[model samples]
Target: MIVYSNTISGFNHDVDQGIIAEKVHNELNQKGFYNSINEIRSWENSLFYMKNVLYSPSINQDLNIAIEYNIPNTSKRVDFLISGYTYTENPIVLIIELKQWEKAERTSREDIVTTYLGGSNRAVTHPSYQAYSYAKTISNFNSYIGDNNIEIKPSAYLHNYKEEYRSELENDLYTPIIKKAPIFLKKDTIKLREFISSNVKKSDQGKLLYEIDHGKIRPSKALQDAISSMLSGNDEFYMIDEQKVVFSTVKTLVEKAIINEEKYTILVEGGPGTGKSVVAINLLAEFRHKIVNYVTKNSAPRSVYFDILRKDKYSLNYIKNLFKGSGSYFNSSKNEYDLLIVDEAHRLNEKSGLFANMGENQIKEIINASKVSVFFIDEDQIVTTKDFGSINEIKKQAKELGSMIFYGEDYNLTSQFRCNGSDGYLAFLDDLLQIRDTANYDGFDGDYDIKLYTSPTEMKEDLKKLNEINNKSRIVSGYTFDWVSKSNNDIDVFDIELKDDFKAKWNFSNTQTWAIDKDSFDQVGCIHTSQGLEFDYVGVIIGKDLVYRDNKVITDYTKRAKTDQSLKGIKKNNNFVLADKIIRNTYRTLMTRGQKGCYIYCEDENLSKYIEFRLNKVLKKNN
Candidate 1:
């Protein structure tokens, strides 16, 4: 997928004649690729300088050159790649990251530099570190790199920076990365050419580039071992009988579609804790040979999964390609992926971009991107207005696209695996919350622990005790509290205030692994952070947004926090019923996150009494 590839002699000729940028742009346009005018301008500037550096008499003109080489199964592309051989005839590739930054400032974090980008001063990866990571990702994922015993050399060339700014780019914090992949500034053009010439002494006539582009891709042995070790002895990875049935059915469908070269959309519908994520991960691990990816809209579960799978540094570089956000397929090629297992499909956004003006429907894009698209959805989990991933909508889109949709008992997971396999508990919850009617409205017979708390402090104390035993318990709340800074220096201020001096901070935004971080137990996670995740025990704080009024659950959109983006403008909408439904759905999803037990603290006294009445008098009467 290289946008431009040719012999070094040909590239030099094109660049020397000042037509290289136009040639690359014409090729990209012909391929239906999207690139902004600003990006093309940067490419022209960088390539013009690159031509000067590679035009040295010592550099071999017959070497292979490629620009904008697309990384397989990913949205990223390398800036430039040169393939040749050293004097010993060993294959070598020089991965160059070209930057046009005239100035950059060191950030508080290592390997991160701040520069003016996208109309604002933003933190971006240091060029050298970026190049090194790109090279490492290729080495870890590309089978050809290992099979051919190729040597990869990564470097960054900042052609617009002055010599005095070199100190900032070569800071002590970035010493290790710079040692591995040196940074070349405008003054270091001669040195950069010398480094390039030193590595590539002979030309391979572009054979190496062709092999890399056309090589068979498989998970590296190290990656396979890492995944196996992560899944081994993990009880959560084990699937139940119903789960196994669904897994077998979906796998067979995917295989059949691939064999027949046909398109199929398999929808797996289940409520919370029906093992959707468990089945999705198992499918991902088993279907390594096929071009499969796990897609989700929420970052919390995806980040937690990545953290759990790639505990070591070696696996982290390659694991990211396996997981993608739902929006990543907006401009993807048709039928590019063999299988796309979309987890938490209910969270898929309608559109992407900062203003949500870019791209068309994500559902259509996902369906168009893959031959066999398997979507695991929970209709009740549509917590936001933008989420349009209903089973009906998916079916409609699939029909419009001329793809067959398969959903029935074979696709529905009935057996509950969470809350200690307490199906009655879920039924009782549905009835008590008035989200829907259930047979267990009056009583629930289950071993799962459920309790209502009079105070938030008591619920926190109980959660602490539970966490001490298993370390898989935390307090989560409705988005009712405003996250405000108490002092200029303290950003993680106590946001959730309660009586008896009980106060806690909202979960840290930077802690993507909040569910697993031991220190995060004290912070209260909102719905966005807790969705698609499970814990041994959960403490839920029902906020003022929901109340029990006139024997029916009522929703007050005004009670929701101003900081909560999901609930924004719901109060202004004319559809009160829809708003209430979304609010109830949010609470239901929160309460069901606990695998074995759930403790509750409600802000509304009337709601608390109603919950108790259902657990006690109503249940006893029904019995």
Candidate 2:
């Protein structure tokens, strides 16, 4: 597909927008390294270990070089250079051809689809394929030289050269595997590699896959870790022993009820690792809320929001305009909303304004915005950040809103169910990082809510083991917060294909076909797609970039940013806090997505430390 660089208006051209044009040009010019002929030559020379005979003047090499360097012979500057030789002294040793790299302009629709799907649309061709084609062409180029050298007419030699080049091209480009020796072979070596390289320049599968895993291919700092964790299968949630359930069983059940609930001003008190943002989105879907506005304490959370908007079938631009009151994308009788949900509500306090003079506190504005308001809070997660909303403060706001009191359901989902259910690590986290808290379940004797595993490889192995226990009943899958780097007609390339099979497997038989780079209905899974939807099991990927050193303990973004008073300091720490919030929110979302249990993959060493620290505290208290 033709990817148009950001455009400049006619006015810009008339007014000498040279600087802007230069900027645009620079950005567009930044294609992959192998997209040019100059790059191929540079790369070939850099290989440093090729056979010297190929470059030497051994078998009629002079004639071959002369043909390539000849003037006025520009027949599309033939990329394929083939030479064959039967030296009287060397005994017809070799035949060689070469293929030169060219910045290929995408020529077909299929090219766009594959690149977009595979998430490498930015890269013109897979590096491996490019290398192989170049080698094949090079080999074929050498086949043109034979012993009859002087006796053979120029026409016959030229015909041989063309045939050799064409033969190699056909085999390398169309065959599944290279039958003849193709000096280079491209093979996938990592996860998702096979899927990405399945098709050739026929499709933009790389970019598409990148979008599917993350919202955009190159995510901002806000979602860097989350996206990485998700793609790598590093985020998950587990159950603590009877004593602690951070995303405890009770909390999960309660969340399910709230999502299923049609009426009421619901309040959720989620512990750390209990997915509050995920629950909010699910609840929005269940209730069919007209406007689902999500606000979080960090840039990561905002990135999460973007992921959901872009991945889901809902038109993001339409949704964005809904807030503007200018578009006709959606219509509703009520001016306010059917329901209002706030995640990380603890991060919003008396100083934050929600609406016109509703109150400085966010809770007040939330209550005013809808008939039924759902506030998901965690006082501990707030961690002394400025404008931190306390549970007590929320209770007061609820009273002022005149909403009937609903029993607060606390989450104990602290099973540390990731890293192969490592309880030791979980216990370590609770003891080291969290503020001490008690639960009534502590009195009972039972399994440690936390678990431990050797490493990520073991974690995946354990998942296979768990799946074996009950394959149909317990579906083990993952969630990612990846980014989409390319777009087709303003639609995300990743969310375009809503797999009929994936939907059917998930029991969404009625789900419509959603285009990967176009707005479609089945985008919600993790942060990229799961904006206004829910799932039975959700896996979250939390990374270390989200954590910052604060008093030897990892702190959330709200605590770091809002608590800092100096404007300069806040700006300086903006990235740090934003990173923290996104990671934290990712955990919150994953924890809540599960109606039964959540899985986690946390590659960030710091996140693992934090999880271990929390689990340790829970274990110590139980002991």
**Top lDDT prediction, candidate number:** 1
Cα lDDT, model 1, residue 295: 94
Worst 10 residues of 1 by lDDT: 219-228
TM-score of 2: 0.31
| Per-candidate local distance difference test | 0.79, 0.33
**lDDT of model 1, residue 113:** 68
lDDT by residue (493-512, candidate 2, tens digit) is 34211212222121112222
TM-score for all models, in order of appearance: 0.61, 0.31
> For every candidate structure, what is the RMSD over all alpha carbons to the true structure, in angstroms?
25.3, 27.3
What is candidate 2's local distance difference test score? 0.33
After TM-score superposition, the amount by which residue 246's alpha carbon in candidate 2 deviates from its true location, in angstroms, is 15
